[model samples]
Target chain A: MRAAAQVFDEYGLAGSSISKIMTRAGTTQGAMYFHFKSKENLARAVINEQAADLSLPERPEGLAQLIGLTFFLAREMQSNVLFRAGVTLAVEQGQVGLRDFSPYDMWADLFRGELEAARSKGELQDDVDVAEVAQLLVAAYTGSQVMSNLLTGPDRADLPERIGRMWRYVLPGIAQPDRLAELREVAERTGPAA
Target chain B: MRAAAQVFDEYGLAGSSISKIMTRAGTTQGAMYFHFKSKENLARAVINEQAADLSLPERPEGLAQLIGLTFFLAREMQSNVLFRAGVTLAVEQGQVGLRDFSPYDMWADLFRGELEAARSKGELQDDVDVAEVAQLLVAAYTGSQVMSNLLTGPDRADLPERIGRMWRYVLPGIAQPDRLAELREVAERTGPAA
Candidate 1:
């Protein structure tokens, strides 16, 4: 799986091959077939397990935690090969003739859950639709990563900063008036360390 | 070019073949090579001409015009096959082993020009970073379009609405205090017709 992730990350789904992954893994074709059955299955597994290594520090489940989660993800995209590979595959899945949107859907649901918690705690504005905001965040983050990766290279060195800027721009429109300042601060301060 | 766009849009760069494009275009391979020596060259041409069909109304060149441009793009993404194909190729260029960042850079420059005008007119907040906001807007718009296409299908039925929501969410963070409401109103009102 690790080898597959590395291969997919560098070459993308259409460019990756089972033979290349097998060579990288130092495994026989028969063993590879026994494990993954097909390259598509292996790719899907990578996508599903993209977040398996995420170790976010436990934070209260609300807006702050959500902000922390994004910061953590931005950091991960910079250094984590597996996670970055999964994101690349997901974005380029159309080229692979795969329409799997589960990764995007899962992120949207997770963000929605956080926003719902924020709403319950009066951290969100009354007019803020939790689902819409959640979806927007996911899309915005996805785009930010892509742009950062394209402009800043595969390391995505500036993704964390871009994400911080994104939160600063978005929070005032959705966070409760009195909580906006605090939320912006949280977005700024919550990073890999937090 | 139209045939090439359709083929590239549907099959992407790696999946598309010169013969296939020729078949679709009803042209000889010799003729095709006369215009484009390689698939990569053709893909780049498509990306460069992505906005060739855009005919946005002449609006004062500032934030409102920028907002109108995004709205127009949202609507175009739904119906313009050539435009959609160019975007898909640009995003999926990695699959074709192409690293052209010109398209994205062009967009950022276009957006930055409008934002700079907005700043000169005091439509933006004093603390706003024009270049950063322009880059953020481009990234946000790209992500919104990808998500809308993914969730709402290839037709991207809700793309215009998503773009509108994006503007509403982002404007509050950078627009001048008094201009916020008017800017948002412009965002809401500026659409396909305008």
Candidate 2:
């Protein structure tokens, strides 16, 4: 799976091949087939197992926890090849056959959980739309990492910092007026996992 | 150029070939080489000319103009083959050779222009960081479009609406407290070019 992810990450779905993946993994055809049946199946397995290994930090403030989750994901993207590969596949899935699952939808579902908690705790403003904000954040983070990686490579110095700034731009509209400043500060304090 | 852009948009840089481009363009090798020396050179030309044909609307409010430009771009991505191809090349440049010109950088520069104008006009908050905001917006929009394309292709219904919501969330932080309400209304007014 790691080898397949690397090949998919470097070359998109159309460019990737089973021969390249097998060569990278250093495994025989029979051995590979015994584990995974086809390239599409392997790609789907990679997408499904993207978040299987990591743990998320728990912050008392739900909004802060949400920010921390993204910060952590950004850090993981820099270091974890499997995570990076899943992201690359999810973004370019339109050009490939693996359209059954969307990483964006999963991320948004996770965000909605935190956002609802923040709202119940009175951290969010009355009119803040949770679903819309979740969608925007998911998209923003997705695009930011792609652009950051494209411009500066995976282990970028500014990926976490950029996400921090993204929360700064978003919190004012979502956070309660009294807690806006505090939330912005907390967002900054989520710090660079770099 | 349009043919090349279409091929690149469908298949990324690594997957695209000169033969496919020429066949799509319905041109002979002599005609093609007479204009572009190599595939890389032609790709670079497409990248540089990505925004050359776009003419952003001249709204009186600079912030509104910025929103208008993005909304315009979202709509164009659905209909304009060249634009979509350029965006694909810019995002996936890491997988290929055309790394010199970044679409994100060009977008940030354009956003900075509008942001500077808004700041000078006192429409923005005193502490608003124009460059950082520019970067965030560029990333946010890039990711949003990729997701939109993935989910519903370029002509998606909710893309412009999503972008509208993005500015609504962001403007509260960037706009002066006095103009926040007015700016939100203007943001909604920007609408989708569709």
Most DockQ-accurate candidate: 1
Off by over 4 Å in 1: A56-60, A191-194, B56-60, B191-194
Instruction: Look at candidate 1 and tell me the lDDT of residue B140.
Output: 84
CAPRI quality of model 1: medium
Which candidate should be chosen as best, given lDDT against the real structure? 1
Per-model lDDT: 0.83, 0.79
lDDT (Cα, 0-100) at B104 in candidate 2: 75
For every model shown, what is its TM-score relative to the native structure?
0.93, 0.91
TM-score of 2: 0.91
lDDT accuracy of residue B165 in candidate 2:
81
